[model samples]
Target chain A: MNEERELAINPIVQTSVQHNTQVVSNIRNLTASLFGVAAGTLGLESYPGFIFYLIGTFIVSGLVFVFRAEGKPSEYFHRPLGDLWGGDVFSGLSSFVLTWTLFYGLVRA
Target chain B: MFSSPDRRLQIADSQIRRFTDSQIISMRHKNEANIIPSVYSTHEHTTTTPNSPLPLDITLELLASILLLSTGIVLTSQPLKPIQWSRWSGKMSREGRHGTGRWTREGEEVLSEGDPYAFLGLDGGGEGRRGFFDVRGKRREYAEWVKGEPGSK
Candidate 1:
């Protein structure tokens, strides 16, 4: 397969990949929860709340792209779009929701 | 070396942010308890209304904090090594073991387990390998050195 040849030609370092992924995911999860606090503090509801999460994540991704990836995602990630942008978005959602609801109640109560 | 200061700054920033957040929340709670009685005043309602948008200052502060936090996290993360074998090996040989400064929390250098070929040169394998040694050539060189000495003449 073409994929096999491509991999053989330019082999990827598994440890480096895992380390980079772990760092990005850790940042995403921490920032997602922080975004939840901000949204809840601002009293955002329903659609606006979710939209805020999206925007926050986009900003985080942009920061990672610019500073972390050094404007070249392809060098760091195997699939730049999937790994850097979309990867672990869902994984952070649970923590986001947890902090979102907790702060929403605390702020509004 | 450079990351230590940056990480300290990040920690300070987060601590300050947490303090500010708690202060703001506590102040809001205090205001709510004292300002609003059973009468349900319009002024209290205007400020405490769930539908009302947050002040511009608070919104700006939140966005700024997010930006700062993201930058800190990105900068503090470990630098990624090249994935290609050739590049990786070049980097390893260039930086050597201590040049990378990848130390553990206990201040020990992280051993690179990825390079299996590292052992090839560790024991002088290339220069001293069996069957490659020229014993006769060494003996000839030693005799020539002795004959050229002043004591031999």
Candidate 2:
């Protein structure tokens, strides 16, 4: 009761609580991208042969950073952290299309 | 304690106006408090709530696709299909822009990258659908639960 009374009278404690929640939200977002990279690496060796496989590794790492940007606050995800896994879905889908078109055009021709 | 009649009347009117103004301010404050509670409650629901977007089976399909793309394997025999990425890209681009300035060979590769859903965990190929990648049961379940609310219909 005393603590509540003090907090009600003190603006500083209320501000601190708000800031702490925002900080925790930020941490949750940062941790999510680490998961993104691990998920990205699941089928990496499925590419053609040697060179594409290395390319795959690089792609996954890059994805870790690229997708991390999406984990921040936005109207869509609407949290302190952006949606890293969601961004991975997007990047992966695009990567798939581009690879299929170029590979098909080159090999088939 | 006798003031002039006109003075007394003026004081009474002034006090009445002050009381009305405070009442209006209090009403506004109450409305604001109500809105704050509702917003907080909704936020609590989304982040803390544990609902899955796609059905468990479908989510497994989605995660398989993500896993494949993550592994850097593309199913070459298949034709390219554009999913909901264009919409996602629009939102992502607004934050830190991707693939700007000069496009390197590596950048080109990244741009023309394979399906991320394959890696994240979605199946993208079928007679009526497509497989993104492949996964077993436990890994599939873990991936689906971890990924965001899938926007696929």
Candidate 3:
């Protein structure tokens, strides 16, 4: 059998390749959204609310992306919506609390 | 003895992750003093397990919740109230305006008055609106309400 062919046929190699492909797909999604968020947040014409929105999106999306890349709920082959929601809820509550507590202090000071 | 060099190398690389994962699990379980090897290996790892962690049903539920949340936030953030106009035979309004041309309609039903809250799925106390977090509450409530149902916990 051909060397390259034999290697390519390995199930482990296939799994690795699948993993790599998933990573690349996730990276592309993140990069594209990151740019959009940055533009919205820092744009001269955009609302100041955009800045808070961007920060919130970043924290939530970052957590979700990491968990997804880590193969959370891997048995289903597709990442679960509950994972994303849990991530979003947790992040939202965190950002809401942090922004109010910390940002308010900074503004007041 | 006839395995090609590239084939052998490929096999080695393929075994690398699985071997590493197995070793890490073993090391973790054992909690041995010598943990230097797994430290370096687990650092660069992303997702390397012998099997996926979540079961099929729970996984699906989780996925459903995520989709719901993303869509919900986007839809709910927009101001979508419908325009309404009202008039009376003769009435003077503020700002030098007259003829009872008020926006409020006390008895008139607004067309296309779909509740945006409901649309975003925040309008109900039911499971459909609660997502995966509802599973536990719903189960416990039903178990108690079912009246002598077994496994009521």
lDDT of 2 at B24: 38
Clashing pairs in 3: A80-B62, A80-B63, A81-B62, A81-B63, A81-B66, A82-B62, A82-B63
Two-chain complex of model 2, DockQ on C-alpha atoms against the true structure? 0.02
Evaluated with DockQ, which candidate comes out highest?
A: 1
Highest lDDT scorer: 1
Give the top-scoring candidate (TM-score). Answer: 1
lDDT of 1 by residue, B1-153 (tens): 112435534643554455444454343233233222211222233346656644443444455555555555556666765556667677777666553457889988886544555544454647543445578889999998988897776
Please give the range of 10 consecutive residues that has the lowest summed lDDT in model 1 chain B. B34-43
How do the residues A1-109 of candidate 2 rate in per-residue lDDT, one tens digit apiece? 9966753553222232344334333432332332233223222223442333334434443443334333233312322233322333333434444443443333222
Going through the candidates in order, their DockQ values are 0.36, 0.02, 0.02
| TM-score of chain A, every prediction, order shown | 0.97, 0.29, 0.29
RMSD after CA superposition, every candidate? 11.3, 33.5, 29.4
The worst-scoring run of ten residues by lDDT in candidate 3 chain B lies at B82-91
For candidate 1, write residues A1-109 as lDDT tens digits.
Answer: 9999999998888877887788879988877887787666666789999889988888888888887788988888888899889878989988988888886776665
* Clash number by candidate, in order: 0, 51, 7
Which consecutive 10 residues in model 2 chain B have the weakest lDDT in total?
A: B73-82
- The sequence of per-residue lDDT tens digits that candidate 3 reaches over residues A1-109 is 6956743553122333344344333433433332232222122133544454455455444443444333343322223454333323333433334333442233222
Candidate 3 residue spans exceeding 4 A from truth: A1-60, A71-79, A85-91, A98-101, A107-109, B1-153
Work out the TM-score per prediction.
0.67, 0.16, 0.18
